[model samples]
Target: TATGKGFTPAFVQASRGWTAGQWAEARDRLRARGLLDADGELTEDGVRLRRDVEEATDRLDHAPYEHLGQAGVERLTELAGAFTATALGNGAFPVEHFGKG
Candidate 1:
């Protein structure tokens, strides 16, 4: 996930696998589909839709293993922080965004 107020489409596109042109094209398609705003930010409805999709994905990712409880949640949170550090090259936890505190 992105940190802080975040950056422009250039930054986001660079982070993903798509080239700038491909990113632009895909972004246009998404905007046309009402998934993004004219400026490329997510619209209010898009925000809720994305949140629901993310929740569903999270549930699916956690559903396969049984017997996971509070302890498992804590462990997964820690592991997620570690994963963000290793994968993103940033060691700090974006607690302000994730509401961990």
Candidate 2:
């Protein structure tokens, strides 16, 4: 879905530590499911599906943050934001590829 959202397969593979074959297989599967087009772009349904999955993932991941409480969550976010910015600036990952929605 990252590729469908405008990331390159290479970027995804590199960032996520997936092999080229694995990425290709996943892409093919998504395409077969009508989530991706022949050109590897996301169809409308693909976009919706991706958004739904992200929402569901966020819901599932919320428990850890809740356990931290509001203030702790805020602090963690602040610290992580700084780390992320530094990583972006340092080119720890492809910013252009990862930054797209």
Candidate 3:
């Protein structure tokens, strides 16, 4: 899905700590399922699947944030923002691959 979203395989593998063989197998499976192309680009089905998965994840993850309440959530976000920026500046993750969300 990261590849589908324009992230390079090397970046994904490095960031996720996936062995080359493991990444290859996953890529092959996605391609066989018609979710990815031979070049690793995502098909429309892949895009939809990624979106659904992300939505489901967000829904499940929201409970803790809800428990924190709006102000708490805002404060958490503010606190994290600086750390995130520092990580970005330090090349903890590729800035180009990081989305605003």
Candidate 4:
């Protein structure tokens, strides 16, 4: 089920369920639309558009929470790092050694 790396057959199968021709047609349509280049990379316009979208989303949706101070930020950062390490560690990070209150 390999459609040559980066292109996952599982993702394609889930989306189209058995249509290489359909996928190719849709892919070609995207290339025609100037969103994807022939080499499968996003066109310059597509990259700029995606960046614009992300920047606009951040500008419109995210704001600095003014309530937290420097000390609070430091405490939160430590807790977040410990939590993430504990959850995702492969015996590499030892959160318990840091001790808990």
Candidate 5:
């Protein structure tokens, strides 16, 4: 979800619950590796890294819901999509990142 422009430490911390220290260390590493800028925006390399991470996490996130079956998955997806749309509408998320329309 963060491969888009303006990816930042705050965005990740809000979702991943990382500690300050962890984020600091990660920020340093990202800069040294030319993945992120000082402000935490992803560089091109960072975008690639984020894409890979997102792909892996997407798979992991899907497994637990496998027991829900196809119809259940569809229902859950619809609900989740609605929530995301609402979040976007309320300016809780960047439309460019979350908008599927």
Candidate 6:
């Protein structure tokens, strides 16, 4: 909602299975929490909130493979890219997934 174009009602409905009212309520809560401004832009705290959440999510996602180390992670990404080439060229990105025998 902050950096990109805001979601349309249809997009929110289709993607999140949320009605417009539900989506608005979610935004309202964010505003009430001081994470968003009246205009729906992210406040400074909102940016930090997003960062914190992303960092935590990243940690949680990687916690399972910390023992793999940097090298292992790189190889995993490369293999994942090859495996998901048809669907997503970005590979191992949105997913920490990888593939290759």
RMSD of each: 6.0, 2.7, 3.1, 10.5, 5.0, 7.7
RMSD of 1: 6.0
Best by TM-score: 3
Could you give candidate 6's per-residue lDDT for residues 1-101 as a string of tens digits?
55333444454465567877887888899899998898877899999988898889897887646878889888988988778785566442332122121
Residues 1-101, model 5: lDDT tens digits = 23244445455566688888987887788799999887766789988888898799998887768889999999989999999899868898674433432
Give the local distance difference test score of model 6. 0.69
Q: Largest lDDT belongs to which candidate?
A: 2
**Candidate 3, 1-101: lDDT as tens digits:** 44645566777787899999999899899888999987777789988899999899988998899899999999999999999999878997664664322
Q: Put the candidates in lDDT order, highest first.
A: 2, 3, 5, 6, 1, 4
User: Which regions in candidate 3 have their CA more than 4 angstroms from the true location?
Assistant: 4-7, 15-17, 95-101
Q: How many clashing pairs per prediction, in order?
A: 0, 0, 0, 0, 0, 1
User: What shift in Å separates residue 75 of candidate 1 from its native position after superposition?
Assistant: 4.9
Per-candidate TM-scores read 0.57, 0.75, 0.77, 0.45, 0.53, 0.62
| Model 2, runs deviating above 4 Å | 1-6, 15-22, 95-101
lDDT of 1 by residue, 1-101 (tens): 22114444445555566797897788788788787887777777777777898889899886644567778878878998888779657734343333322
Q: How do the residues 1-101 of candidate 2 rate in per-residue lDDT, one tens digit apiece?
A: 44645566667788789998898899899889999998878899988988999899999998899999999999999999999999968987664665554
Per-residue error (Å), model 2, residue 63: 0.9
Runs of candidate 6 exceeding 4 Å displacement: 2-12, 69-71, 83-85, 88-101
